[model samples]
Target chain A: MNVVGRRTLTVIALVALAIVGALTAEWWLSQSPDRPFGHTQAGHVLGWAGLLLMLLVLAYPFRKRHTPGQRWSKSLFQVHIVGGLVGHLLILLHAGAHLHALIPVLAMLAMGLVVVSGIVGQVLHALAFRTMNEQRRLLLHQGLPEPEVEARLQALAKQEETFRLWQVIHGPLTVTFVALAMLHIGGALYYGGF
Target chain B: MTWPPPFSMYPVLLTATLVLIIGLGWASARDPESFWAPGDLSVHHAGRMSCTQCHEPFRGATTANCIACHADATFISQPDSPPQIFHRQAARERARCLTCHTEHRGTTARITTDPLNPHSEFIFRVTGTQSCRDCHAGVQKPGPKYGLLNNDAVRRLVAKGKGAHGPGRFADCFRCHAGGRTGAERGS
Candidate 1:
């Protein structure tokens, strides 16, 4: 019906899907002859899927840049977040507890850092937006005109959004992940990986 | 002031990414087995730095690689030859090298020796199944196996066990005295 209702529904749906997916993965792993560790076929599939998802997540920045000032950019951002979360889950599943290789372990660590920093960025941005909205509502209630209220909100948003250090963390971590992943892939191939 | 545009650092990140990828490729190309290998290759292949010797580009080392090296009469002539026989068996069975010999294990020990069999660690080398307690005192108690037998003591232990157990009595020593079944079967 409304934006809040739509957003709430979307979040609930995503959570439900994630829970179901996790349960299904757990069941599949249980039935497998081997644990779904990275060495197993299922684990390899998950790792590949996770890498693909990371590629999608990496594409988001380009998507946003190319589609600047477009409404679809917001949807793309949401996709990026979902893709990143799913990718992280797949990777964690693939790794399980037995992270043995050096390059792959480093890649997993970089992926972890990227995912954590991304979540931090999301939380910080949400907090800033909420605070700005609350301040705007307060200004509006005090009988300020819409234009001045908007200006005040923008100023508050500017101040709060300045703490975008998450970008510094997120971007470099992504780069590191990509680099390590490449190294892992290259190493695997050189060592006779099919 | 506002933060710099997110894209501002793109050049740096790109450069770093390129540098790391290139650096890895350069190092790995020269010595892939030791560079990023999980474990050291078996002693048989340990001296080899080039992964390309066994592994094909992207497809990895197939039985073909083994065949390439050991398929000739030189390897086949010796029935008891461990490496050549293993390669021949693999070829007959159409087995992948990875089934028995996985790489990048971070240590060459895995390729050289079996982890499951404890007797492999002993340097004295028992000819047959013998009481482990002959060397490893107090190992028969219900706990972890005793530490490795001392090199000097190994010779003495082997001689003593051989003399005491002879061949028939010690046949099932591994069945009881080996780590898993407990020490109840010792000195039978």
Candidate 2:
């Protein structure tokens, strides 16, 4: 109904999608243990595709930092969010509940954490932004002077600072995921001969 | 004022991530086998922890390493044996042994892929045939291609009737044709 409600629903939908993807993978593996899809050529292709999407998602942060005023910033952020979730789903399919090595297992865990934190960060950012805009609109309606309105928004800005703190967790998890994923890729190349 | 407080789990999650990273790094550096091994080695190869025994550093496991120990002639000579036939065909094509014989799947896990059950494609690829009858057309009679039929006990089974020797029923050929046993002993 409202902004926060919509944001909460978005978070729930993302989490539900992730759970469904995981369950589907488990079901597929259980049905065909003798011929695991993860061992197939298609599986490797999916893994690479997912990894590429994840790498592309990093462009959003780079663009935001280097050129915040870019016309395509909003579109790039949308791509980042959608690409990240789809990439993670593809990877979950590629893995197919077949991971046995510690490196891959750790990488998957880190990736999961990164996705979870990213979703939380997205919701928090949207809430903070919308709340500020709503407050500013109400202040203008109340006929507050422009300077006074600006002064009041500064207090809300401190609350926004707290919301941005999700980045502290999200950023580190992403770094950990990247490090572990690189190691996994190295191991696959060295031992898998591909 | 802040409408909502910051996530309470932020500090806990950050600490967990740091611990995971540090712990994994230390384990990987100190004991790579524990950190990198896909799973426990099969019982036949359990004693050899050195990956280099079967694997080349960057090229993965090579057929040369597999043949170094399994260079027995019977693997090629025994056409009646489905596994041996599959292996012979795979070797002829220079297929990597790892394609079908993956290791590090627990001590008692079946390492070799079951061709008849799971990988009928191997047979089709090698013989251009899909069914057992396509290759074993003369399975009822003694012949060069199906030498195991020459055994008297097997011949007797053939005489028993069509019910016992129906298609797809002989999937477990190894139940009788146990490795290292003579054809007579195998059929008995």
Judging by TM-score against the true structure, name the best candidate.
2
The residue-by-residue lDDT of candidate 2 on B36-64, one tens digit each, is: 77777876788755666677767777888
Put down candidate 2 lDDT per residue, A1-194, tens digits, no spaces: 98677867887796787868765875576453344566577778888999999999999978866785566477889889999988988888877665678889989999889988887788777777788888999999999999999889987775566565676677767877998899888877777675
> Judged by DockQ, which candidate is best?
2
Query: Over the stretch A39-148, how does candidate 1's per-residue lDDT look in tens digits?
Result: 66777788789889878886778865576556546676888999988887887776654455567778877876786677667766666667778888899999999999
**Candidate 2 local Cα displacement, residue B84, angstroms:** 5.1
TM-score of each: 0.62, 0.69
lDDT of 2 at A31: 57
DockQ score, prediction 2: 0.27
RMSD of each: 9.7, 8.6
Q: Find the number of clashing residue pairs for candidate 1.
A: 8
lDDT of each: 0.60, 0.69
